[model samples]
Target: MNFVSTRGNVSKIGFIDTVLMGLANDGGLLIPEKVPQIPAERLQAMSELSYQELAYEIFSYYVDGEIPDNELKELIEKSYATFRHPEVTPVQKVKDNLYLLELFHGPTFAFKDIALQFLGNLYSYVSKKTGETIHILGATSGDTGASAIEGVRGKEGIRICILHPHGKVSKVQELQMTTIHDPNVLNLAIKGTFDDGQRIIKELFADVEFKNKYHLRAINSINFVRILAQTVYYFYAYFQVAKETNTKTVNFSVPTGNFGDIFAGYLAKKMGLPVGKLIVATNENNILEDFIKDGVYKPGEFKSTYSPSMDIQVASNFERYLYYLLGENSEAVTDLMNQFKSEGKIVVNEEQLLQVKKDFAAHGVLGEECLQTIKKYYSETTYLLDPHTACGVAAYEECNEANDFCITLATAHPAKFNESIERCDINQTYPIEISQLFDKPQYLEVVEADNDEIVRKLEKLFSFSTR
Candidate 1:
């Protein structure tokens, strides 16, 4: 199936082009012309497949013969082999009706690894086939930068630059990106919030000439492929949990920041997966939660909570969801987005707001409540949640019905956020993977919020610009 630009200013493009183009030239996100629907029987049959197997099934509909089935299968296989768990994303029964989808089994110990691994391999595959060089540009609150770096590091014909908010992310998270000594990876600590880095990245992509000249691509959820790869775990987790609980529908509690993760769940629900409700769990930065609960979409002051990743003023992926919520009226979507940009807010009508409530439920968890959730689960059970996942658990506790089978997406390993763990005063030890990070020499350029320095850096460091 061809992908179409959400803004309606660009023609329908193939999956390969969509993957490479990333942010559409029209300054809109790419979405499928039509989200493929799976028959109940077929979807049930897919339930028995492994994580990689299920991914191939879901992805084939979007890959749509542009890549051969065998080649696609190989790509899926190679990508997931990096995961340490037998079930790449394992479903653990934390209690009777509550389950945790462990997504930190891959490299970087965060949920982003699941998609970045595939995207990195896909980039290499495409580059070798077409003899094209690429430079992947993205902004990260915490985990995404390291995951994306691990994905494309040292690969021929591919270079990646990641900009993160300086001193805003956790110590471990900062070291994860800054300590990576790969020649092709450039890590910048922008002197601002994650939103600042994100805005600069988007500004760079909006420059069509510069985007082409540098062969810039996105490794963020703004890339349709990342969202596509993420959907598989929801399906896999559903199948495993449903079979164990003998339940047909299972709700997912996702710790959301950029709206990309929950949007994947929305895509799954739209594709006819028996997804009950996508719980949009937020930290103190509750722009998404507020908008979902009410129709008011406005950015508030950025809060540097324990969950720094969720501290975003403007979610880059929210526009894609806006496109669908407006029923694919590209003109209206464009108009509303422009208004949100110019006015810093967008309010929906009562009718539209009701339709939104039907799609997902939202709740915001405070910083102290999040830590308490972490402490409660760790003390009561064996599972230790990271700060972000604690937000999901907190929201689930506050918003879940007694009978609903809920799966909280464990977005990161607890080791990544020692700040929260320490605050909770819990007895826990980090893995060697985490403790060893302290010994490595850190490296990153601290830059102002402007794009000029970034542009100059990319130009100067086009060839192994490690500095």
Candidate 2:
């Protein structure tokens, strides 16, 4: 299937080209020219397949001409083999009509691993085949940095530089990225919010000469491969829920900041996954919650919260959603995005707002509520939740219908946020695997959040002489 830019400025491109191009040159995201639909029988057939099998089935439609079926299936199997759980992403019953989808089974103990692992393998295959090297630049709030670094570390023909807000992520999150000593991995702690790092990356991509000179690529959700890999778990969770309850409809509550994870669920619904409602759970940075509920897309200042992963004001994946929300009207999507970028706000029309509300319900949880959720769940079921997953649980409890069968995504292992869980005296025991991470020495560079400074640092890291 061919892909096209959401802004209608770029010509039609294939999947591999889209992967390499990342953000479209016209300052827009790329989406498939046509969303493939699965037949009812095929959807039913997926319930009996393994996660790897199901991934191959779903991805076949998108990578038809680019990747062969056998090669893609092998890559998928190898990618998921890194996860500790045989199911890759497992489902646990929290209560009647309420379940917790455990997505931290991979090496990094976060949902981002599910996608980053696949992207790592896919990039290796593509780059090796074409005899090209890719220099990946990415921005993260917390989890994405560690996961992306782990995915591409020590790989030949690829180098990655990840930027994150300094003093914002948890101790473990920071160490997870900084402690990795691979020659190809460079970690930067910028003295600003996640948006600052994201803006710098986007600006670099927009510069034709700079991007071409460095052969830069991306590992952020703006890369369609990340979104495509994430779409698998949504289907996997739904399959398990459907098989157990003998029901077709299931709802998912995703604690999202960049909106990539829930956007994957939205894509699953488009492919006939029987998704009832997508609960867009957020922290104090509630721009996504407000936009989904009211169509008022105003981004305010970023706040530092216990759930640092959700501490974001600008949701990049929202642009891809708006492309579909506006009836695939590329011109309308471009106009609205241009307004948002220029004015810091934009509102959708009534019809578009109605369409958004039909598929999404949103709720924002506070820091106190997040802690309380961990305490409450531990008291009742001896289950400990990280700050981010607690937001999903609180959102599910507050907004879900009484009879709605809901699955809240457990995005990270609680051990990753030992300080937050310990603050409440949760008295939880962590796995030894996580306990050992603190012993590793960290190597990271700290820089002020300035575009020119970042460019100079990157040039120095890559051995490129300044002009």
Candidate 3:
């Protein structure tokens, strides 16, 4: 299972290399050379398997040569055991055919836990095998920071630094990252938007000397392991729906910002999972919607909406989709990406535009729509949803109604956004654990958007630690 860079310039790499190098040297995300297929018998038989069992069966192909069979099984089991739910990811039927897939039942109460937890385990295993220490750097809009921190905190032979835009995420989300005062953990409140933070991470990766000096790895969606771990729930949800109903194809409406979650669904379809349309639900920052509907890909101002996690203009994972749309023409895709970065937009050619429309259906919902969905769900079904889940629910209505069985991803627990949830008149309270996080003092550095400044901070931290 070799991984190839989306930019097409870098040499093909083994699974471990792909995992370690989140983005290729050519500035592209790594994708599998081929998306392995799951046999029909296996898909049918999956209905009887447990969540961990299903995960092992589905993900084995991707990590086959990298990790031995027994070790892989152990990793999967241990990774999921930490989750709050035994089922790992459970689905609820809010109405006749509208289902809510609960993915926030992990330590961080966000969908990122599904991937970040497993990724943390995978990182530990690989680091031990190679006898190397790794420094993980990630940029998060909201949930990914807390989830990544939960995954890597207190782990040996690893250091994690997460960057979030200053004043972008909610107070709870900020505390979730900053309250963890482990020496292995570092948090940065970047004086810019999420895009600026992401750009800094990318620049760090591009600097070979800095990356190697710090043993820089990534927990971002750019890492193939994160995507592989995320793909498990799609299959789990599919089988659960199939077992309960006679539905052949299940449509998934994902409230997306970085596009990683829905891209996992795209990987599942390529792997022969009977998934229908992959609906992309966006908040006020609706760059994806515009890209799918028309051929224009543009970046706009980052609006601080109710769903802070989806307040992103540049979807990093979109590069992989462009790789597929261009028939794996990495050169062309790279050129387009460079142009898009320089000009802030790019108009796709007709052929590429046709492919996007074929597989994607996108819709944008405002904060009011999110509130309305939360209110309506509470009134009709008594199902309380966070702002992110409400965004998915609102966008699901704009997509096809013919697909009766639709799974809307509940990305985060309402407690993570208690203020926003309260604004909707939902009257939700935080968990005891979450409520306690507020009292912890936040420890973080505020840095400008200069690469030298970030490097200087890292140097000072490392020098102080060594002394």
Q: List the residue pairs that clash in candidate 2.
A: none
Give me the candidate number with maximum TM-score: 1
lDDT of 2 by residue, 1-467 (tens): 88999999886798899999999989899989998998888888888999999889888888975887789988899899999999999999988898999999999899999999999888888878988777889999999999998888888778889999999999989988999997788899999999999999999999978887887888999999888988898989988988899877999999999999999999989987889999999999999999988889998878998899999999989999999988899999999988887898989889988888998999999889999999998889888889999999999998899987999999999988988998789766767777787889999999998889888877766663211
Kindly give the number of clashing pairs for every candidate: 0, 0, 0
lDDT of 3 by residue, 322-347 (tens): 88888888889989988987898989
Superposed Cα deviation of residue 412, candidate 1 (Å) = 0.3
Off by over 4 Å in 3: 463-467
Q: How much is 230 displaced in model 1, in angstroms?
A: 0.6
lDDT of each: 0.90, 0.89, 0.87
Clashes of 3: 0
TM-score of 1: 0.98
